[model samples]
Target: MIPAHEKSETHSKIDPDLNSKGVDEEGETTDHNLTYYQQMQEASLEQLAEHRALLQIFNLHQAGRIEEKWKENESLVVWLGMQIAILKRDFTEYSNCPAHEYNGENRETDEFDEEKELNELHKKVLELTKLRLLELGMFDDFPSKFELVETSRPSKNTINKRFNKLLRKIPSELFPSIRELKFKNYIQSILDGIKKITIGHKIYYNQVTADLEEKGKLKFDYLFQTIEFLLRDHFISENDLKTLFQEDHILRIFSIYFFHSSQQGFSSMVKQLTPSFITDQCFWKFGFSFSQVLDEKDKVRMNFELLIAHLFFNGNRLRGFQEWDSFEKSFGRKKYLDHLKNPDRLKLSTSLQVEGKEEVPPLSLIGTDQEFSGDVNNLVKLFLATLNGPKKTRALSGLVCELLDFINSNISPGILDRSFKKLGSSKNLRLQFDLILIPTRINYSMAVAMEFHDIAERNGLSLAPKVMESIFISYQDRVISLNKELIKVYSQFKNRYGSLSSWLKQNPEYSKINEKSLNQWLKAMSIIIEECATEAKELDRRIQAAHGTAH
Candidate 1:
């Protein structure tokens, strides 16, 4: 048996041609024969046509129409020039054809071949005309239409032969200057103007922006005219056109134009040219241009506000709305009531601690005192600044937590309860909070606990008694010591009374209190109050906790 590599080589060397006839298996000989046959056929046809035309030219020379020969020759030259121009135009159009063809195949055939052949014939006619003109000594003097033709004209074929020869030596003068002049005067001139206008517009916008910024006041008329010119003449789309008007310094130019145009009853034109919706679309769709108008900071804020508003407006239609409801439901009714009652829990403090500035006053004082309102506004601004301008999840969550805390601390329980019911009816605040918070599973527990505390504290109540009872029952192991002490106290207090049942009948509020229930309620209240402390205490604890070592 052969080795594997040697066997593969042996198979590879076994040529198919070895089993075939004398023909090379590569097919080179057949391909060469086919190509040679085609070339020979083309050459034969060209030779035949040349010979026939020569004989015809000889015959035409025997006839007499010599005087009209020059006109014929000139006509042939004109026809050839026209054909060339048409070919050039067709070539250009084909070259720039759009990418609509499947698989990138060429679709057009050489349908202009007949016209090209006629062009060749005309070239020959021109050569005959030119030589005849030279022989008549009219080449030196400007030949009139009649002088170039022979009185005894050659046969048509002879004339055709002479024209073909003339075409081979097509002189710059053989082609009439008028045709060239017309092309340069008409087509070229228009193309040049288009090029100039494009170049000019680019330069003009750059210079105009620079000049306007330098002058500090842009001329409204010039700006408007420039914009219109760009749109109409340059094929500039609405987006690019708007960009020219977007530069802060340049756009100011339009402010005056806008006002003047509106005053002159050109409001419709202005609307058509620069609609607000279009402007907003341009800003949003093309962020760079939008940034140019509002600056990056304001643009971000604007977008964030718009996003929030859009989400709020479409909350019911959003899939996430159900999840938002689920989150609110998780916090329970009592928690939401607490949020409404306590404004302290809801009012987020500014993360920026401005030194030497008095603490922000109460909202009630905002209406009564101008300075107080100003301070509050400033504080609100500062808090808003802490929102990280826009679309900042961390900042938003912090703000939501602060607001809930503020409401929990400040708002009355009755008002908070009403607000909770309203929240349930409207459900808009849930959406608003969700837009800002973007709840995560990791932060879910914290958010729920914070909300629960804020709502309960604001409502001037504890967590639902049943909830406390449930927690105590579920986590009895964790609270067993506290429960035992509470049981001892309850037993002693009950012994001082008739019995556990009698004590409960005496005071319904405490009647059902077990050792575990008492402990859990106290623990739940402590958790709620601890989480609802003032900013100062919260900050201090956070700082110490950060430094504190775990035992």
Candidate 2:
């Protein structure tokens, strides 16, 4: 019998038969196939997310950018150990496959030496994700079967005191080396091979919005120039950017976009361009043998696909390399984009007069076939998807930086522009967005539970279990309402773009859009990280404090 915990992943057009059965491990038949689709999608998402994280580590190593100090990081060592003893103790009987197969014996390297290298790989991926996906292994949710869990969790104190299992990292050999990997060609085929997509299924195009030779020119230039422009003056120095982002890191990010676009003459040739783990996972289909799982007529499905595409693919959209990528790559829930700006109206208004240029070189606005605004809203969506995905929060944090770049990038000196910002938010981000936004039921949920936990810890008061449960229900409602409010606000803001005429585009909505927008964005972020969902009110100011972040 497949154990209840056995992971299954499925991503495809919904079987036209809702009459299809959804079966559980106990051989019980209950709901429709969508239930099973979600379950399998979620299981596959976990595999994809883990695969993506490991892939990024290899990418960092090849790029020679994994930090040297990661070699013996203790947190990493602890993170990469044997499987959780409790699971081995109890659930082993339920698992058909081991959480991981251990083969330390007869390997070329000593177990200690191999552990050390893997520790370093774990650390680098954590840092890499601190900028890109959900912080993995060392922080947030471990890719391991046991997640740290979502809201209303026991205080880190209570859980640590009870279950201090010394888990071992699985052998690295369980995974395929970059060369041995079989997913890339499949992804390219999705992009390069044009199936007979009808109107409702216009997710992929032959040129991929252009042609290969231009291989993501519009989005690439947009991200590069946007990063340079944002960091160029108000945020950091060119010298600092070089030090903060090495050539390999920057160039690879560029190539990620480059290969996915239609570069005029090189359209077909660009298919041969090396794909990154980011690209791979974003478009990853777990041997189901399909590039995309989309239905244009399904508005909800279209929304998921479009949002994923706009946020991760097309061009880096609002995402850019940041100063935080240099130091804040751990999986902590500290507000990642705090420096992007404080959302307090007065502070934001004062802070956002960041640009000094008057007639800057025309910004790259790639208006190919389809374009829409509200790039930043999708980071929140991406964040939501990561928890649900099997998507990682890694890109959520990094994309938060880019969202700031989108929000704070200039239309004219001293006035920030929202109307003109366009990276099209898809293609690679789209491909990955396409891949990642599977909206598998999130493995976890957070809210009032953590708040009560924090309240108990801060005040040193012990309440009865029933009392906490009652309070938990009450606070959860408010948190849910606040989430609705945020969605409503986003709807209003998005509609503003409908009438965003040439003048609105030229003048920009610095006052209209900046303060409330950042405030809502930051507040929502405060709520839904892997660690816990925060109470949204006043959270814009206390993003880090609420998360109990040490650094």
The lDDT of each candidate is: 0.31, 0.28
TM-score of each: 0.16, 0.20
Candidate 2 lDDT tens digits, 1-551: 11111101111112211222332222323343446544444443433344344435345553232333222222222122111111122222322222221232342243234334333333332222222221222233222221123222233333322222211122344223312432233222221211111111112233333322221233232233223222211122223333322222232333333234212222233222211222122122111111122111121222222223333443342234332232223222122122222234324334433354321322332220012233333433443243222123343533343332333332112111232223443222322221222111010112223432443444323222333344445444544554454345445435444432332354231112244544553454344331232322233335445345534
Off-target runs (Cα >4 Å) in candidate 2 are: 1-116, 119-150, 165-338, 345-551
Tens-place lDDT per residue, model 1, 300-376, is 22332322222222222333433323432333223323333343433443222234332343454232233222222
Query: In model 2, what is the error at residue 246, expressed in angstroms?
Result: 19
**Clash number for every model?**
55, 51
